[model samples]
Target: MGTTLLGIDTKEHCFEAQFHPKRPLLACACITGEVELHHFDRENRTHELAQSITSHSKSCRAAKFLTDSILASTGADKFAALSDLETGKQVWRCKLKAAGYSLLALDTERFAIGDDDGGLRIFEGRAPKAAVSWSENTDFISDLAMGVDGTSLCAVSGDGTLAVYDVRKSGEKGLIAMSDFQDDELLSVAILRRGTKVICGTQTGVLPIFSWGDFGDQKDRINGHSMSVDAMVKLAEDSIITGSSDGKLRVVAVHSKSLHSQILGILGEMSAEYPIERLSLSPDASTLACSSHGRPSVQLWSTEAARRLMEGESWESIFEVPDEGAEGEGAKADPTAAESDDDSSEEEQPKKKRRKEKKKGKKNVPGSNAKQHQAAKFFAGL
Candidate 1:
């Protein structure tokens, strides 16, 4: 029961959505600057004239899908354009000084852009012009991902950091991995390949899970989203499929932090009148496409019945749980028996300091530091 999807309301500021890697069509963005492109079929209905179109004049933020036909859009006024998904026409616009949010096609002849200050240009061939190459935050730069061999790139900043550049090295060359939650502002990032693991999402409602080589304490930590997770999807090398902003959606399994399935929404259009942002999965993960919150009404899901109800525990042994003093081998000497119980607590500390001076509070005149500084200067110059 796959082919099904709907959502078309171009009200404006719809940020992103794209799928045409083989066309059943889907493309989005609206904040008035339009760029709609729905097309569903096989009973999955949608076709307001094969889906409308327009381009930045105001709010678009980002929209992608660069191969299998071509499409791109960005806004907030730094404009950006490329079209021709079977005759939409535009071909190129480029204004950029700082106004993209995030977009990475990285194929169909190079494509990458992440702005709103943290620049990161890269545009290639015909009418294309952009080349900041790399830059680093002062504010927005929501998300970027390209490293399946496009060399490298994985961004996420709006003040939370998560870089990792090295796209043929020049400036932002590194193993960059900064993750500070200070006020929590990451939003999203996913890189499950090379080395192994890197998933993030914040804005308070957490979903960490780092460890892609350097390792350090975070191989799992998902605290029931109260708001903000926006989207995530891997579905294989250990499964993953999140979405939050409270309209809830989950499938996590990261070698078992468990929660193998969940989906709730119904009435007033699934989940009390919208609130999800984005989510996509279907390169054979079955099919899932969602979007909610305002002009957010896109739906389609059924990854073969949630991957057969996520199979019940085996997410590597139901989220493994064995590392508190790692029991056995004398529990690694229990911190030296907790430092010999701090040497039997310094041999019971002077019998608890003379029973705490017999429970009193004001008594310190056992003589001379210049007679207690002359009795506190004779009672402060009374």
Candidate 2:
């Protein structure tokens, strides 16, 4: 099982949670229009509220770490603001034409926000106004991702399109390409496979893969989840951690050559009770922070633990189901047995209980030898 390092009860739903670029701090944008920073001590396995700032008049929809000392946030109040993390004060605030739904940090000196009216705006460091704003998407922009070079920006929208822009240019000249409308709304996006592929998470649980420059249509699709993939973060060039509407977080491996993908492992033994809303990986890539829709708490998990399981011999067992047939056979054998034997001594009864418990424990272990051997064969073929 993956280790849960900490859980913070915000008492209000957190729309997003982001980790500091250099410090062991987490920033959360909440439904109450508040932005909170929490300081965590990994050695002691504890966390405390460091600061809280009222950022918006309405729900803060997204937040991103612009630098080690600055956090950028946008909200339903139609405003975007930058706050100084050390002083816990607003650096500058700007009112947009519409409510901002997604935010992305291009670099320490520049950032971007996508608003509810399909507006995409880029703002230079501490600027009170957008350097440039445009409306290419016909619906709300659900997510935004920055390319590896920091010059290319991508946005996924509720209108079922993926739009790309060149941060170096402005207005229509910056519009690189806009994809054809897909069957489902795009919720999240990531640039993967060394910037050769753009992966867009859809409302229907499919990942539409677009070739870097070819946004006309999806080159491939990976139907990996049973519910909507609400959020995703690239862990490696070929792997990503996806949070789904089914409340499960899974590590998936993407094969560029074969245009195939598979679930490498799941983050936890059991799914959360609510849909996952956001996923943020720490700068060092050692920790992951997650928040769920309608949930009042944020969970921090050990990323190393997940990586260890993925690379371990029992990786395939992460999603294994219990052997119901074996369990049923055991149940049948005990159906007519008495709860306690009247003729037996108390000492004998205790010993019998111990043996039964040991036997039950042995039966619950995942992946038998045969199953493991088969898994090896299956992966070899891949």
Considering only N, C-alpha and C atoms within 3 Å, which residue pairs clash in candidate 1? 12-30, 12-31, 12-32, 13-30, 13-31, 256-319, 266-271
Cα deviation at 131, candidate 1, in Å, is 26
Assess each prediction's global lDDT (C-alpha) against the native.
0.55, 0.71
The 10-residue segment of model 1 with minimum total lDDT is 333-342
The residue-by-residue lDDT of candidate 1 on 1-382, one tens digit each, is 1223455554443545666787676687755667788766635455453655677776665677767777777776786788776777667788888667777777776677777666777676445576437764445566777656566577766555555565655453433433332245566777764536677777665767665533222456666555566567666666566666555555655543354323211101224334456676655556677765444456666555445435553222332336663322111211110101112122212121111222111111122123222322321221
Candidate 2 lDDT over 72-138, as tens digits, reads: 9998788989888778788899999988888998888788999876789999977668887777666
TM-score of 1: 0.31
Q: Which stretches of candidate 1 lie over 4 Å from their true place?
A: 1-34, 39-51, 57-77, 80-96, 99-177, 180-208, 211-231, 234-239, 242-252, 255-287, 290-301, 307-382
Model 2 has a clash total of 0
Query: Which stretches of candidate 2 lie above 4 Å from their native place?
Result: 256-260, 269-272, 294-296, 309-312, 316-382
